[model samples]
Target chain A: MDAFQAIADPSRREILRLLSRDTMTINALADNFDMSRPAVSKHIKALDSAGLISIQNIGKERYCILNQEGFDELQEWIDYFDTFWKSKLKKLEMLLNEKAGK
Target chain B: MNRDIVHRWQFRQSPEIVWEHLTKPELLSQWLMANDIKPEVGHKFRFTTNPLLKFGFDGIVYCEVLEVDPPKRLSYSWKGGPGNGKIALDSLVTWTLTLKDGGTELLLEHTGFSGMKNYFGYLMMKNGWGSKIRKRLGALLAGPGK
Candidate 1:
């Protein structure tokens, strides 16, 4: 799953939000949602595929942890827009200065 | 999971000059803070505010270079501190420069923020880094102190 697909479903986003606070076992997370274990597991699989979450087997139970490194790609995309605004603001600053000089 | 913030600026100088100021320790100290910065990857640096005014950064702003592409991009990790002793959150910051007709366009991005840690850290960086840092230090760069 890509970034867009991972964030499309509210359930997946909620799961990510929960994991961000702390790692949790599959059963622990299933307790929060009304869905069944299989449904929650499916959501976890999608998140893992998207690189948004990671799973580790701790003896008998598996725990899910949030992974933030994937968001760097998204950040790189957003930086382009930021460059645009800075140029615009600079133009405005110059225009104001020119008018004030008159 | 990662909360990213981007900030940008337009400097009244060429990309070369802005790049120089950004990389050079002395020039950076003029606008950023008084500290030493070795111009190499994995090199560490510190930025300190004036002790008299005591209104600047609470502690040394520690940074490590992650990437450096001249006249285009520079990325680093930044960590600040509280005056008392506790170190603040660590975040990745990147600065990009593009040559424009009038001047150089500066882009700053800070990411890798985990959730809300403290009230002050949230407030200070909630906006982007370029705008916030420029508002505080742009005038100095535009003027003659350095």
Candidate 2:
């Protein structure tokens, strides 16, 4: 699934939120939620496929860490919205000034 | 655990000019906010933004300069407000100025954000700092003046 789709679910978002702070092992992460280990593992897998999180083998355990590179696409999308509103507001302000003969 | 955001801008001015504007009260007020800054380490200051009055930190960035290397780097501690019952959420904001062929490259990093754990705080900080640095500061530096 895409990044947006993967983060749409609250469970997945929570997993990402936790990962954003620091890396955690699968068992440590599973302990935070009431879901079973398999369910948590599925959420982690979906996030991993989306390139939002990466798993690294540390000793015998695997740790999941946030990979912010995926958010660049999202940031670019938001930047467009920011530019659009800024220009639109500037045009509206100019129109209002002209009407007021300023 | 370095949860800091770094932003860089290349300005068409000398490092001294950029540094002056960054540290001077009048120039900083135009872009950053209104504050009484002495440009000395341990000097306390407060920045007030009218919009921040509602959420309580509009221009309420209480800070103290930690280090100042002229035309190069400046580091300061950024606190939220009065030190009574406040959680003392402090961050280190450092600015490094490098002389470039065209002009000067200003690099800013806001680190040590251990207290911004909540979603709303994080969102507000992301939007607020991004706008101030990318837009307002850019406009000020691009304006006709040293």
Candidate 3:
């Protein structure tokens, strides 16, 4: 699942917002949702599997925080395209310059 | 939005000349990649490069020109993957050129993701993160932990 898939739902987006400022325990995150806890958990699981968030256990609590993994997927795409196009365009610029010089 | 890449660049040249670099195969290969690209709409072409086997890509970005409006607008279908009919991404690449500042303003839009599924799969495979994704998927299927 990509970052887009992870945040594809309103609930998931809300969950991300809830965790955006700081890490929140699973229970704490669930209290904000109107849906059943299991449904909320399902969303959490989806987000987790999609690498949007990380679930870490501190003692008996499962804390959730925004993870860089999925965002990195997005960033990777942007970076690759940025580099790909810039390099090609640079070459084109040089080629055009050469033509102008000639 | 949603994985679409939009880029803009300025070229100190006429749209006619910039358009040539975009359409002519020899000129395109000098800047982009080796290909048999043409300005004709519906013309099929492929940009070939070194194979990236790790990503299951044969290094051939198959494309088909979709629209061409000489020196103004152009669009094409960009498809690639592990060959043999399997594709990781089925995207559209569109280019628009505007005459401004006595130069050409080139805009590129690569869209058609998020509406599809295989792109994430392709990226995951390309990044060699399949094992980690599988682990996460397993955890998801096992239901949430208490």
DockQ, every prediction: 0.02, 0.03, 0.12
Winner by DockQ: 3
Q: Report lDDT per candidate.
A: 0.63, 0.63, 0.74
lDDT tens digits by residue: candidate 1, A1-102 = 554457558788778667656789999999999999999999999999877788999999999986655444333333532464465445544643454467
How far is B13's C-alpha from truth in model 1 (Å)?
1.8
TM-score of 3: 0.59
lDDT string, candidate 2, B1-146, tens digits: 22445666666667887787668887666555688876788888877655332222333677899888898998888776323435324567788999998577878776655332333234334434333323322321231232
Q: What is the lDDT of candidate 1?
A: 0.63
Off by over 4 Å in 1: A1-102, B1-3, B50-58, B83-86, B115-146
Candidate 1 scores an iRMS of: 16.3
The per-residue C-alpha lDDT of model 1 at residue A79 equals 54
Writing each residue's lDDT as its tens digit, candidate 3 over A1-102 gives 545556657688778766756689999999998889999999999999887899999999999977755555433543565678777778888899899899
Q: What is the lDDT of residue A30 in candidate 1?
A: 93
DockQ of 2: 0.03
